[model samples]
Target: MKHEFTVTSILEDARKKHDALMVLVEQNASVPFLYMDRDENIRDVLYHLYGWHQILSDLMTKNPIPPIELRPGYTWKNLTELNYKIKKEAESYTLHEVKHLFNQSHNHWMSKIAQLFDHTLNAAGLYPFTAPSNLGEFIHECMGGHYQWAIQTIEFHLGDPYLRPLLEGFKSLPEVEAIVLGGSRGKQQGDHLSDYDIYVYATKPIDVEERRRIIGPHVSLMEYNHQFFETEDDGVLNNGIGIEFIYRNLDDFKAMMERLFNGQVNRGYSTCFLDNLLTTKIIYDKKRAYKSLQDTYRFIDKAALYQQVIRQNIPLLYGTQPNYFDQIVKAVKRQDIIAVNHRLTEYFSLFFDTLFAINQINHPGEKRMLEKALSLPKQPKELEKTVGKVFDNITSGDFLKDLEQLTLDLIKLTK
Candidate 1:
């Protein structure tokens, strides 16, 4: 059996419709308004989606033989309630408050997911279901398909001019490799007006910088890297740089798709660029294709730790730690299941400790202590001015001094 995966067929109609909508929206000063309003709205919607899935996963875990009809209740009313709660939260905030609210809401939802997964595992006494299967699978499906839809929707609403250039550039890559789009936009938004975040794949490493030069003035190339990996007893795998091109060749395009389907190659990390999409540009040789699905999977897992540090630790250091942490602790302590659910307790507790450690490390004069806490293998030259510049950027000198006090306090507390 042959599986046919065509990016054009999947995206074309939505892209065209979205472009029309963007044209309409751009008539007035609605673009910025849409951008601001839609950003939070989309995030709220995704949280609700994730919440619905978490609830359903929990329900299924609690009862192995539950009726399928009960699933609707888990989604509709629950999502509605969450939507209301989010709206209410939004209402109480000033303009400055909205930025962090998104992060807080996301963290809360992720915590709920963790709890739901824990309960599910405990109830089943085994991992439930398989890939592209189960309640989580439903959520995954929503994330993959609906997310793209949302991006298209946003693009239609905003009518941003970047979409055309992105599409044209995508058409220019080689024909056989895979293009995997990742980062924030790839994960969330699904609209045509959105900026394109694309990763083009190739069998042999191509000249990414040269391609960027060819794309020229219309596209703005942000960051590009040529990744070369040595395969075990096989030749090296060369991937071109990140490009914002205006055109692509047919052969290069097909090659990109084949490599993508085979999981032969990939682009770099996508944490920053939230709106990117993979184009599957070229496949050099079919039989010589490499397999990297496992590697991609592992990278995602490892990336979670980095995300945790960013989402939880860095935010805490930045004075954005939710006061809800204490509330969570109180709620967990009140629950009779805490002692029985040692794993959950331990996991959250470790997360809490890490958060506190990060806070302490960022405390004033902590730069001196960072040398000790980080325990880097090599001792680089001290750059007090550089450290000071970073401190100033994040907070005033007072915060830096407070960090120093916190570090001393931590040392005493530990001793």
Candidate 2:
């Protein structure tokens, strides 16, 4: 019988395959299985499968799954490293614990995939920028192909320990009110170059020496007090993972959040801190103060915030005589690349702040912005192309025209 490939079919097949795999796992689970020509066992195979499920689950939670585009952070060439990390992370768990985790992740994947519409499942280019394959094919590869591969490999043969110490050390500090894991990893949208952004909120200064004493042993390279935009201890962990220990004054941060929430707007880079606060994962909370603050500001006045951002930034773009456009025009005339770059930066900053507010999302930080903007449901027509044109013509006479066209296109979204 020819097999059908619908959601129901996928689910049924996945369940049957999972049951078969589990049974086989039970039968020869104790017999060491060489996985991928590595010194790995049956437990390693289960954890490896579980890790993929977890990745898919995270992607599903974020709507319109960004192209798996080579499994989030690692490319095809370096996938072995990702796999190695997955295996290392699961090393500490007992066989029983690993089984439990595997089951949890597998069930979670099924639940999230089931929530999708049939059209979305079969639709092509749903994630166009990277992997143009339809969701159904992707699902089958992860679920069906991977499970089949695991079964065949077991016929022949078959895990991130770092989080614990960091949490424990930070939790011990009396001055630390909350420890948050931010950046791309926290958002689950990390690429290969992403790092661990540990935002440490404290009541008082954490002496540089004290921080070093806690975090130094785990990291091979450490730099204390690099004050570029924030005071942070930047270093690379022994495992070659980059980490930044960003310190923030809890009370001051709270106050700033209040102002942003209450309609205050900056000329540029507005809502960035708000974005950071909302997106970060709470690693440690001394007295739940951080949690309370998050709860309090979690739901903002969207319409009000949207209007405030638009009202504050729209005029700065082009509503006034000699606006940002005019300024950039004059700069380009004088061949002032620096001034042109500066105004362009301010222009795009406010442009993005307005765009994100209109879409009802907090402004995610500075990088991968165009990618993020393109993902938003509400955006100007040909956003990527237009933005690209502006940059392409930055030093030419066409610069102002591109900028004006871009600004006008964006402005129309407001109405």
Candidate 3:
């Protein structure tokens, strides 16, 4: 509840805390989050803060301080009824709508704050409407204070049992700039089979021994410095939950994001890191650098990147001499099952990149491709059925021809 009231400090704190809360909201929105201290879900918390943000905007902009109510017939004193109405109204909205409304109102309120001078913000009675208290105080309570409360409230319900102790141990290392919960767990879509995919963003590498020493107590089985893909530690928590500790240099990760923002496109998995960052929950951020990066690129326009992703990946699917379709044809001709599977995997990667681009959604990583695609607003009809058929008949005589038709169907959707 404590906050700095200086114009500069309050503004920075407001933005930082807002970004943190947004990340938290995104992480927990998919799951049922009922706060024990109150009868509220995540949407209730979001619309509650959003309602206050709207009030703050009105208070700052309206010259004579127009009458405001918690609802039509309610005042601030009718707190319980006010909250009930708010929650009831929010029940009609989807999670996406509530998040959008909250985010937009915050931005609008911040813009109003930008127009105020320090004297106007920090001095009492300068704005007689907020008498006995300065605008800065109201700003703190509405924006920063309210954000912290919402964050803590939702986090209270969504806390992971093993995450707290793990974060405590990792926080001891100076080299760890930030730590995040990534993959399905971070996205709030994890089932029983899902693991805790932890990403450690560091200034420099934490020695393997140090990592082992830190994570050993919490994990039953631990593997150190596995370079199967990224350099990471593989472990199973004492509670029998699988967790991965993947290391990344903070600076290099920033550079990768910069490249994506500037339209650098990979043949496949073009926006994997972008999706990962947006979906991650900041378990430990030592210097606040990770949150800053999240704020910078959170709303980045990926129109160009999407086009580049489709352009670079779609061609490789077919319609070229050495395309995936042709490669599959040659592999099938040789009756090489391994080669066929390899080409099929690459084919789907390229296929999905184009699919996601055309739909204007970030690629949601490697697992559950058909499910992810099917969830998108726009996608080829019978997509899952076709994909299932291709895989089931991978050894059938018409495999290459079936794949070509599928590629052509996907290409038609892009056009």
Candidate 4:
């Protein structure tokens, strides 16, 4: 609601930023890249202004109001990625060609912006699916915002020349909505031999074959059934650092979260998702929506969370014996590896649920569960040793006894 800038104000701000960017171009001879490589910073600022302008013109006639959040057949979600695409496309041309296209794009954008009515520009809920906003705000967001950021980024890169290469490498990747750094590297908890756990968030799910193509020559894909990145492009090795590629669809994630928040979580299918959402680090958030999601789930209804956990997990844990926990013990006595392991995972889920319920904490995820649990308010006795014991000695004769003791310990703690 606060972003209702008039077209005149929009043009003025854009003109100012555009003027500043050109000064850099003029001073640097439009060769901002090292040794005058691709059209560096200014190239993007101009090209994206052109794109926003072009998309707005097209939006006037699309059937059913095309999702303004996205453009057709292309994956440019916001100014950040749109600029990247434009810059890449501009690479073929010399600085002169690049400037020519930019001028054309800029004029095209200005012509449309000049025709917007105040009523259309300032109205709320201009589009149904998006936030309450109008054309003026959208133009300001995509056009002006890109310029403002580009200048800052350009200045920062000038100070730290090393960063531009890394940024460029990241930009080279295709259809990247966001790139999040997670795991030990993300949380800054790694010692040595820590692989880069990079989560690639996209507008759509990239296929296994297409994903393998854009990968940098430095990193090799991890083997299927690899330790960290199990199957389906579990890893890439860059600069001798193991890099894992975790591709997720932002659209799918939002839909899943909507279903879960609306009481669909009783099925217990998305426990891992909740964990990842909380634990992962957002390194590159283009639309800046992920943080809002984290905030939404940051504090949850403990009683309700417990209810979901108990309803879904109790029966599975307490299969046929006096209780699910007891039933697990019997399965262990029968030496059913498959059942024991399956039930063990279910117990982990239930145990995680129980811990979250007792402490009223959001689930951080399945990784480092016992360590994460111990750091919480009240911890069960021998929790650390028992958790390791469960996995290590699942087939051990004392597995059932250990399970019983831990279950009883949980009862005592919650009470």
CA RMSD, predictions in order: 21.2, 11.6, 15.5, 15.1
Q: Find the number of clashing residue pairs for candidate 2.
A: 11
lDDT per residue as tens, model 3, 1-415: 4333677766787899999998887776687632121224788788888877766665566633434453457655456556656666777887789999988888877776776677767775665556557778888788888899888768755667776777677888878898877888777678999998988888888898888888998989998999999999997999999999999998999999988877776777888888888768777777778877875766556688887888788778888778988888888788898998999889888999889989887889889888888888777766777777778868664655656777887888877
* Tens-place lDDT digits, model 1, residues 129-167: 322234443433333344455455455334335443433
CA lDDT for candidate 2: 0.76
Candidate 4 overall Cα lDDT vs. reference? 0.61
Task: State the lDDT at 190 in candidate 1.
Answer: 32
Off by over 4 Å in 3: 1-158
Q: At residue 169, what lDDT does model 2 achieve?
A: 86
lDDT (CA) for every model shown?
0.35, 0.76, 0.78, 0.61
Clashing pairs in 3: none
Return whichever of 2 and 3 wins on TM-score.
Answer: 2
Best by TM-score: 2
lDDT of 3 at 378: 74
What TM-score does candidate 3 get on C-alpha atoms? 0.65
Models ranked on lDDT: 3, 2, 4, 1
Tens digit per residue, CA lDDT, model 4, 186-263: 554555687766667776666555555555444554543233533235554554566666667777877877777666
- Per residue, candidate 2 scores C-alpha lDDT tens digits across 311-396 of 88889889797678888888889989899889889888888888998887888988999889989988877678867877886778
Clashes of each: 58, 11, 0, 4
